[model samples]
Target: MLYWFFTNPVSLSRWADKHAEGRKLFFKCLYLFTAFLGIAVAASGAVESALAWMPRSWVRYDEDGESEWIASSIAHVAGFIVAFFVTLKGAELATRIRRLEEESN
Candidate 1:
């Protein structure tokens, strides 16, 4: 997963060429997607932890009633994470489409 975060598609292909002997296309695609997922998870976890450590002014909890601050913060992080990964994956897919088109031409 870290490999994906650190390398672009071309680098990944080269790494596979060097290390993934006899690997099927299915596994390579799986690895790429899973690495993306790992990135998303790491980002989301960081957001959650950052929120948890934010100043009182940034994240205030209700003292008298059922505190919804934690849930709110979590929801915020979750939404950001979903949006981030969706956008990232969409870009990656679009790049793949363009690359395939170029190859076919």
Candidate 2:
């Protein structure tokens, strides 16, 4: 697998064609995970922020407003994951299209 990544451009396409379907599925799963985690983290942040704004006298709580950092970190990681998968999948699609065009020609 590492070799596949290190190969030249022509070799890369050959390698990709051999594992096209598997790679596609892998990237799709990665993309989905990123999306899911991002949403979850953002939701948690929103909830935490809401809680922080709530009247402390009515309901005593121990959570600090530091959850914003957690949310921001998650957002950054999720964004990277999302971007990686999007580019990977787009390359896969472009390769598939190019192959099909070549075959038709």
Candidate 3:
């Protein structure tokens, strides 16, 4: 299934060369993003569990709920950042490929 996506010879060749040139930068960014996501999810889950385990005394007004809210907000922000960068990179790569194709025409 994934193989089919990259099997077009022309696209494959172009993509391979482009990827090779950008591989280090791409993987560095990818791994950093992945790590951020992992940390954010884990932190959010931990916050939720902590809130659940809290004593009745800690369940007062919304002020007491701020920590969980902060954790969840961080997770959401990290997700948005990763998605934004991924989309931006994909669009840039697509544009470069299209331009190359047009030039070769």
Candidate 4:
């Protein structure tokens, strides 16, 4: 999935030399946001799966037993937080691009 996201032709930027600074910045921000979001979502899914497969007995506080679920849950939550920020940044950049286009017309 990560490979597909990075290599997809549809998301590639192909601005002409006359492209405005605002447009370039918008595309840069949009791409970075998408990449980060994709990574976060993938990481979250992996952590969730690991957490789910962990045995419940491991979480019962046995001596020498580690609670893998706790660590996995933390990772999942962190990914979610980063994903939220990336999404917000992406929306803001997109809106800026739209406004600039409207004004240029």
Quote each prediction's TM-score. 0.41, 0.37, 0.37, 0.43
Taken over the whole model, the C-alpha lDDT of each candidate is: 0.62, 0.53, 0.53, 0.60
lDDT of 4 at 84: 79
lDDT of 2 by residue, 18-90 (tens): 7785685555444445545555566656555645544434432336733243434444565566556655665
The residue-by-residue lDDT of candidate 4 on 1-105, one tens digit each, is 345335431233334114545576665566666777786988788767766766655443436765445656666797887677866676566457756766899
RMSD of each: 6.5, 9.4, 11.3, 10.3
Show how many residue pairs clash in every candidate, following the order shown.
0, 0, 0, 0
- Write down the TM-score for model 4: 0.43
Off by over 4 Å in 2: 1-68
Task: Identify the runs in model 3 with alpha carbons over 4 angstroms from their true place.
Answer: 1-69
Which scores greater on TM-score, model 1 or model 3?
A: 1
Please give, for residues 48-73, the per-residue lDDT of candidate 3 as tens digits: 56555444444323655543444445
What value of lDDT does candidate 4 attain over all alpha carbons? 0.60
Candidate 2, residue 55: Cα displacement in angstroms equals 13
Over the full model, what C-alpha lDDT does candidate 2 score relative to the true structure? 0.53
Model 4 alpha-carbon miss at residue 82, Å: 0.5
Poorly placed runs, candidate 1 (over 4 Å): 1-6, 14-24, 53-105
Most accurate candidate by TM-score: 4
TM-score for candidate 1, residues paired by index = 0.41
